[model samples]
Target: MKQRLNLNLVISMSCYSSLYKPSLFHTTTNADIKAYLVGKLQTCKDLTSATLTHSKAIISGLSYDTFTTNHLINCYLRLLRIDHAHKLFDQMSQRNVVSWTSLMAGYVSHGQPIVALRLFHQMQASLVLPNEFTFATLINACSILANIDIGRRFHALIEIMGFGCNLVVCSSLIDMYGKCNLVDEARLIFDSMCIRNVVSWTSMITTYAQNAIGHYALQLFREFNHLRLDKPNHFMLCSVISACASLGKLGSGKITHGVVIRRGHDANDVIATTLVDMYAKCGCVHYSTKVFRRIQNPSVIPYTSMIVGAAKYGLGTLSLQLFEEMVDRRIKPNDVTFVGALHACSHSGLVDKGLEILDSMNVKYGVMPDAKHYTCIADMLGRVGRIEEAYQLAKSVQVERDGYALLWGTLLSASRLHGRVDIAVEASKRLIESNQQVAGAYVTLSNTYALAGDWENAHNLRSEMKRTGIQKEPGSSWIEIKESTYLFHAGDISNCNQRSEMLSLLRELEERMKEKGYVGGTTGVVFLDVEEEAKVEIMSLHSEKLALAFGLINTPKGVTIRIMKNLRMCRDCHETFKLISDIVERDFIVRDVNRFHHFNNGLCTCGDFW
Candidate 1:
């Protein structure tokens, strides 16, 4: 009898642990152990009825108990067999908070937030009280739905249930509020927290960054450090780096880069992407490219960020080259990648290239063209003086949301550039009728009327704009000299340091350029130019000239002056700046109206395409 008992024990143990494992008579009695095995068996296709029956030994022992029943339900959930899980949950004589919470978690995990909420309601009706986990699961549903109302109600419910102070629950609340455009409220909750983790810090910083409050985000980052709390993690670093990008603070971005390297978090892909984006946006494309090259496992986010950064910094060729490399690596381009590519083409006036890509947005890439893509194409055409083609392309889009603003604005700008008054006037009228308070459309109409020699209409439009209190944005330009920047605007004499010198130099430059046969293009004249008034209006109060005068007076001899004009550089100014560059024996980079004009030895890189 003893020998017989020993034989049976040996058989069971061999089945449980053998290499060529037999699948029966498993001897575990812990429900945790059995549930774990059942979850594993559900994943293995070859595990048969014999093994499952062995699992049932412990499952059946705990079948009537809510704790074990919840465990069984969770096992089915791991298999996504929610139906079977629900069946077991229903058959139990009792239901507990854990059972409902487990089911809710399963639904949330599977992206069925609505189903999760429905089950929550059912649980509530069943008289099962919710705990911290229950509210956290429901808040997850609200975040997915972007339902602020549901989120608020959940907040109230958590308070009523005394779970509001739960750090996990409050963390999710901050995240939900931020996603729903309630950053202020999110901050209120975040500040009210008794304990905060890295997640809490990262979420708050990200909220401020998303809402265009970069300074506050950075301030928070400093405060986070001052706390001497847990060291900054990858998420916290990325959040603050993104804030630097939005603010265009290259110094802060560089500091963050140093932090990333020092902390050894540079290996994280998310941190890598944010750093690339920050440097790119801060106008340090070289650093951006360098960081991008070092990425060991570059993903779509980093690739897209680098592409966009290159495009925005006027490195259209580099952007396209990297895009080709991305394709060569089999990395798929998303909508953002195409948008950046199209913008590069537009900015560089690569018309044929832009057209090819716009076609491929739907053909090769399967991304339907959004309004932004169409706007980039239209902007490219208009910048290259293809007013009629731009107008036609604008018409062919079949749907126009804000494209009307873009299309008409582009056409009107092209008209102003090439002296196409008729087209400008027609487009401007439609634009004004559609968007009554748009200051740009009003300015375009006034400029068009002036170009058409209709002084009455030009003055009337200006007067109308004034009566409606629609003020045009003041034209300004920034120039970096001696590592600091100075801004200039029309009629601005407020830089007391250079007032007299700037005006005198501007007059001298104008006179010398005039002697070189450069005349102000009276084509911008409205109400018939009587020569003097046209020249005065064209020459003085021009934003580009004001910026140039400031640069000329402030800089040393032979120093290159770079000015960016908020409005298009008039044809006359383009010609005048070329002669000024020659006379001053200095290069001048003027980014105006539409494109870049680099003038040296009396030539523009654009060759007058703009």
Candidate 2:
């Protein structure tokens, strides 16, 4: 019998061998060397004659160059073998910043941002000088974690390293600050940049869009076109679409769709999803549906966006239809997709459907209910007067104890809606005790107490907040006018241009609202033992009214007014905006901390659910 040596066995033996003596493997071509010694490299198992030319480079005595290490890291990451990747990286005799950065990237890519940050700090402690890639990975992790302090320190380090002008690092910094909710800082960085590439422009635009600075994003997009040596790509068009969605600038959004079509990005799934979101948010339900159907093969993201849009606009049935269609297509839904779907059911008061879907989350899809999912369910239940069940469900959730703020806030607000003062007081206590630092919880709890005639308890809660050094956040709103944004807080008299005129206009709007049966909503004066007039004055000067008045006076007649609030819009303001829209015969869109509210012809999109 002829003894036939198995080539694969020999290669596996060689690949898995520990290189005790590096010299034994020195003779192999780099193309013939194996970088990692696992059972069988997936790359090798599928190897063809064509890969033979490059095989020697991967074997032992292989130049374990940084490029080779990066390739190995890529393979392991693709295989979801992060542990092996880390082990390989640790065993390397010579390691550079690239090796460290690649490992950090693996951690980030695997959604372990904290691990990535840890490695970054370790690399720093080891005195390994980092490069642009390392800083970018670290900054990206900081962005997701929203560790502003860490991000700022990294920013200073980048400047120290003289890498601030590096385009890649600059783009990452802009993205970091943007995602960290520091949009102004991001813009500052963008403006100071000596060079701006497509990535830089995209990051800035998307930052503005994400921050709901839609008009500014559009302005930047126009500037981008004017300065461009190249036509707009899919990413740029997507950002513009998102900005349009944020602002409810549907006319402009449609125009951008035309641009996208011209640029041949209209069929792109990401662009299509953004377009659907824009149309839906702009109150153009028909166009939104049309855009949803135009995508021949929609992905989960677009489907989710469409579902969310439909739900937000009160097209609950349409949203359910899309959800069913998504399931039929066997497309897996992510957490965000479920939020939209469940939110739609909540909006439509489809209690049975909502409960069924919530159960199926774990039973069929293998995804357990997280805080956001539970919050949505609670919000839906609370909206429809299922207060006790909502409270029980909230109490049952163990993870995300901080979510009690949102859950109890919802419960308290619902109690106020239905005159369930007893439950409101109970939930309020839970809320304040759970997270006194959350301003919204304080506001909700206080309002609940006021509704129940328990002003003393409400006052005590407010006093506790103050004593604990938890300052109530000012009611703040943003208005974009003529390509510039102006922020207004309660009682703001900060306008240099036509200050007296703006103040007078606000006073007039308040009087007009009063004449239309809108009261001052003095319930917000939980801490005040004085007359209601002072509280009324305070309510009149609220940031939403100020911003709305500014937009009214500054913008063209019949143009819609858009405002973004840092907190939930007060009940009085939500009602007042309804009256104001009817009075001015114009549309209004307010994105608050919780959700979007659109007012047109004295009707709110929320239908008073929020």
Question: Number of the top candidate by TM-score?
Answer: 2
Cα RMSD, model 1: 10.4
TM-score of predicted structure 2 = 0.72
Instruction: Write one digit per residue (lDDT tens) for candidate 1, span 484-521.
Output: 44456432334635545544556676577556655653
lDDT of each: 0.65, 0.64
Predict model 1's lDDT versus the native: 0.65
**Taking the tens digit of each residue's C-alpha lDDT, what string does model 2 give over 119-138?**
98778788889988888999
Q: Give the poorly placed runs of model 2, Cα more than 4 Å off.
A: 1-55, 58-60, 63-70, 75-84, 121-128, 436-610
Model 1 collision count: 3
lDDT of 2: 0.64
